[model samples]
Target: MSHLLRAEYGPRGRSAGASTWHVVRAADPATALCGRTMDTDAETRAEEEWGTGLRCCQQCGSLYMHEVPHMEGSHPYS
Candidate 1:
């Protein structure tokens, strides 16, 4: 289950990292691994660039963990 790094912007300041990075399956941009509808127009980033410090979607991180257990600690921005 390959995932792509993208962005999910919600209400302004109405979230805990809601405007952070999101994870979407490489095959689909319709919805993210966190179950949030993704913005198809959003540009996706390479998995290598999903490093720390950036805001990341928690739900996506959880789901991604199950998707790739070996890649633990790879999901940044928790």
Candidate 2:
């Protein structure tokens, strides 16, 4: 698996705050690993893993969890 990048895109529905984070690539900025396209220029990127509260792309989440692992003592849950 390749290195995973987490980014947030907004306006999911009626609420402007309704944004979903997804796994994307540095090469393909507009496309998520789950195959959704968003305006990459407007997206806010997460440091490493995605934020906790924002919803995640199911497919991308599954793929990301497997691709990028939390090193021992690195994450809160670890």
Lowest lDDT 10-residue stretch of candidate 1 = 9-18
Compared with the true structure, what per-residue lDDT tens digits does model 2 show for residues 1-78?
344444464547424543667777677767777887756655455536564656777888786667666565887766
Give lDDT per model, in order.
Answer: 0.73, 0.63
In model 2, which runs have C-alpha deviations exceeding 4 angstroms? 1-15, 47-51, 72-78
Error of 1 at 58 (Å): 0.5
**Structural similarity to truth (TM-score) of each candidate:** 0.68, 0.59
Error of 2 at 54 (Å): 1.7
TM-score quality measure for candidate 1: 0.68
**What local lDDT score does residue 78 receive in model 1, on the 0 to 100 scale?**
42
Q: For model 1, what is the error of residue 8's alpha carbon versus the real structure, in angstroms, after optimal superposition?
A: 1.8
Candidate 1, residue 25: Cα displacement in angstroms equals: 0.4
Q: In model 2, what is the error at residue 73, expressed in angstroms?
A: 9.3
Can you list the residue pairs that collide in candidate 1? none
